[model samples]
Target: TEDVEKIKPEFVRSFQFENKLMPSTWIVIRIDGCHFHRFSEVHEFEKPNDKQALNLMNSCAVAVLEEIQDIIFTYGVSDEYSFVLKKDSQFYQRRASEIVSVTVSFFSSMYVMKWKEFFPQKELKYPPSFDGRVVCYPSSKILLDYLAWRQVDCHINNQYNTCFWMLVKKKGKSKSEAQHYLKGTQAQEKNELLIKEFGIDYNELEIMFRQGSLAFWQKEDKNMPHESKGSVQNSHKKVIVEHCDIIKPNFWEAHPSILD
Candidate 1:
């Protein structure tokens, strides 16, 4: 018995890889939809942006925040969402695999479970899946930058897609022609093209389409018993979703608890 026990841990250790996340850092788990371009096409999602699809993603993010006590904030755009855990959190003993897998799996599950709510008329042809990875930032500043960077990307990609789809849908341009037309186009040129060609002012588009979305607690969640298993927190403030500018100092200043 003693001999077997002695060799067992050693054998397991030999085969196992170290996947513990760095300690004392802000942990981020980003989940991206796998092959979502096809997912959207099969589902007939509106070109550029689908408000219902985005709402479904946001709802899943909120569900994850509710389920995971360590996750404090989330930002989502397109088919991806990033969950931010508290810097000092020792969730799952800082195991990278656990952090990524648990959050991402829960998100995917919620996506399926809530699919009908967001798409009441359409049948869910197939379940969607996501891939996740974990990264750590040493300080709050870099973490904020990480989120801001994603928001900027949201702006860039959304602008391009908007123009691309307008060309295809409105002007009867082929995908190839649209892609070629937008090549080497600057932001100003894109804006002008939208105005001159489509008579659409890019600035007048919906705020949610431009800014993406964020999910966070408006107030500190009262720490609940481990046995509590409700989707919604009992606290006065449940997870709130907002499509707001996270790039500015004013946003961070207003919601200090997110970084604090």
Candidate 2:
């Protein structure tokens, strides 16, 4: 029993490495606002009235986790849920658009059944759309920190939209530069540059950007000020950026291939 306990974590790690190939990038799946408006009519009856809603939401989360078992290694839940995927896994190679498509379809089917079961008589009002962003990164630490930040944002904002961000390192660039590049600067020009350099269609790239998501920035604009006119007002913006790096993939290394 002691041996089993000691080896369990190691075994899990080994399995992940063997299957995922030491992930060169981080793949994040984030779900926001999974539960809302379970029971509105019975405001006085709290326990039994709300139980169904809680159960339905839990079931939906389970369904989502089960569906993505092949790709996700570890996950966490709150108002939002985040799943971290192994790098170099077949899942990472898939087009970002495909990832969102599959996720939406699965949620749609699961939610339909769950809603019907929970609210059979009254017309069910679906919660806000489960739109989310997907991001990939090269550093596990960065990805984990980003996930923590996302959860905090969701809790504070009371909004339903979710964002996924990934960090992928350029083959020969220093990690610091890669991190800066991933932060997304001059996104419009970057998008155009990527299209020109890679010969990928601009429209398709836009779709990938939609699925892959964007970065969040807290900005203090010179044009915008606080009501008092003495303090600076800061605005948060979510913007998507994509571009290639100066670093070239090693000829002998198996790097992630961009898919259409």
TM-score of each: 0.90, 0.40
Q: Model 1 clash pairs?
A: none
Q: Cα RMSD for candidate 1?
A: 5.6
- Please provide, for model 1 over 1-260, each residue's C-alpha lDDT reduced to its tens digit, 9 standing for 90 to 100: 88876676777779878888888899999999999999999999999999999999998999999999888899999999999999989999999998899988899999999999999999989889999999999988999899999999999999999999999999999999999999999999999999999899998899889999999987755756555664455566678899889888888999887878
lDDT of each: 0.91, 0.44
On TM-score, the leading prediction is 1
lDDT value, residue 148 of candidate 1: 97
